[model samples]
Target: MDLAVLRPGELTGADREVWRALQSEARALGAPQLANPFLAPEFTLAVGRCRPGVRIAVVHEGAGPVAYLPFERTALGVGRAIGLGLSDAQGVVHRPGFHWDAQELIRACGLSVLEFDHLVEGQEPFGSRKFPVFGSPVVDVDRGFDAYLRQLRARSSKFVRTTFAKERKLGRDVAPVRFVHDERDPAVLRTLMRWKSAQYRRTGRSDRFAHPWIVRLMEQLFHTRTESFTGLLSVLYAGDRPVAAHFGLRSPSVLACWFPAYDPRFARFSPGLVLHLRMAEAAAADALAYLDLGRGAKDYKNSLKTRELTVHEGMVMRRHPVALGHVARRAPVRALRHAVLARPELSGPADRLLKRVGRLRTGR
Candidate 1:
């Protein structure tokens, strides 16, 4: 096989078509992770437009392209998943049985080290280098919203009942509540971003919207609409005021959950959960199959998820000094994070500590 690297926007019209076909075929062949909108070529193209150094590696065998990898390169010869830190699904979009040496791929990309988190499963070579695996929760809505509700109620009847009760009370206490599954208004998008930014700082996490590129990328994605990839902004409103909102990406079969936040004033109403339930209903109505909640441990995920998917995180490296230096700086941090995540006992304390730090950061 031969590898050709080019910017994501450099793919010819025919090549883009072929890329979509490859992704669809891969999904049918049992790699459902390919269904993630984040793995779509359009996503790469959007990121390429907003961020510099975004490239796509096309792998060709004999007469045609068989796989693609979208990544970002840095000046120091370091590489990362395209939209790394933001993208929840990362890996090569390859044919079912294609395989390559991890180090060889790294060399071909002209990088000494390639790093990724939330790397999709079934990715060999790189999977061999993974530090730990995390469970990404997903809501299976293929059988329609009603069926999913039945399953959810079966799993946590009280949680479902209480959430529904809160939704009704939210309507009565605030205003008549309503949900909009596909909101096109840009103003509401900005509102969601502001809420998300405040949420990040409040939780002692880096605010993603503080970066110009991430903000520009989301704006670009908001206008992106296609069969393989579409930006979906769903909102739960009390009368005319949006109580909670979510902006995620969707392919025909799967909706990859991304940014979700709600007005802090509505915290008691559980607006976030209410928004997710409505989003799932809308996704099912749109004939989508799954709502990928992304890899994270949160109470809402535990309450709503129908099942879990495994995603790995780590690096693929070549024998270079840059690679060694990158590993030395990152491995310990990654190890500590995984250790904490693996044990609820440790995770609770860590969370509490972070919140305390958050309070200080927010001057509260």
Candidate 2:
């Protein structure tokens, strides 16, 4: 096996085709699952376009490209999965039967450590230390929205009823509600960024949009349209007024839900839930199979999920200070996250604390 490192922007036309082909062929253990869009060339390339540290490692067997590994190498030689925080699925996207030593890959990349959360299932050779498997909630809509709603209603009748009633009430209180499957307005994206940032500050979580590179990347993706993957901004409107919105990426079969936010004044109306319902309806119509709500322990996920996908959180590392630094900085945070996810009783206070902090940040 041979490995060739190429800057994402430096890939030639031929290299790109092979990279895309390898990505298209990667499946979870060659199962029937669709190719994860996070691993696609378009995503990594977009990240690279915004972030200079991003690179792609094309793994070759003989003369054929068989795998594409995307990662970020920091100035200190510490590496991580590309777009670690924004990317919901992380892995070495290899073709079937193309496995390699994780440690060797780290050494070859000249990295002291490679860390990741949200590592996709069926990724082998990563580590012996595995974090607790958490469900990334998914709503399968392959059979159509009505059929999907029936499944949701069966699982949580009250949740279904309350959400539907909220949608109806929102429509009545405001104007007749409308959902735009793809809203092309850049202003809407900016609004989402502001709302999402405020949401982060309010929750005491790091606001990813605080980073300029992330902002640039979102803008690029918003304008990017492709057959394999398209950046979709779904906006729910009340009359002519936008009430709730979501910005996500969609492959042919999967919609990767990213950031979703709503006007706080409409919190009572639960417009966010309305937004998701419209997303499901639109996605089903677009022939999408699933809405990946991503890995987390939010109450909304519990109520909305029809199924779950397991994503691992851990790192593969060499014995070095970079690795130790990562372990030191992240272990305690991960411990807190684990506790919050594991114990439902703590979630309320946590949410309240986040809101309080956010209020403080905003001087409210």
Q: Which candidate's TM-score is highest?
A: 1
lDDT for each candidate structure = 0.90, 0.83
What tens-digit string does per-residue lDDT give for candidate 1 at 153-232?
88889998999999999988999999999999999999999999999889888889999988899899999998788998
When summed lDDT is taken over every stretch of 10 residues in candidate 2, the lowest stretch is 25-34
For candidate 2, the TM-score is 0.93
Give candidate 1 misplaced runs (Cα > 4 Å). Answer: none
**Per-prediction TM-score, please?**
0.97, 0.93
- Candidate 2, 1-364: lDDT as tens digits: 4888889877777876775565555443463232667877888899998988997888888877777789999989888899998899888877777678988888878788887887887776886346567689998888999998999888888887998899899888888988899999999989988889888887777888889999999998898788677899999888988889999998777899999999898999888987898899998998877899998877787777888988888878889887899888988998998888678699778878888887888788
Task: List clashing residue pairs in candidate 2.
Answer: 202-358
Report model 1's TM-score to 2 decimal places: 0.97
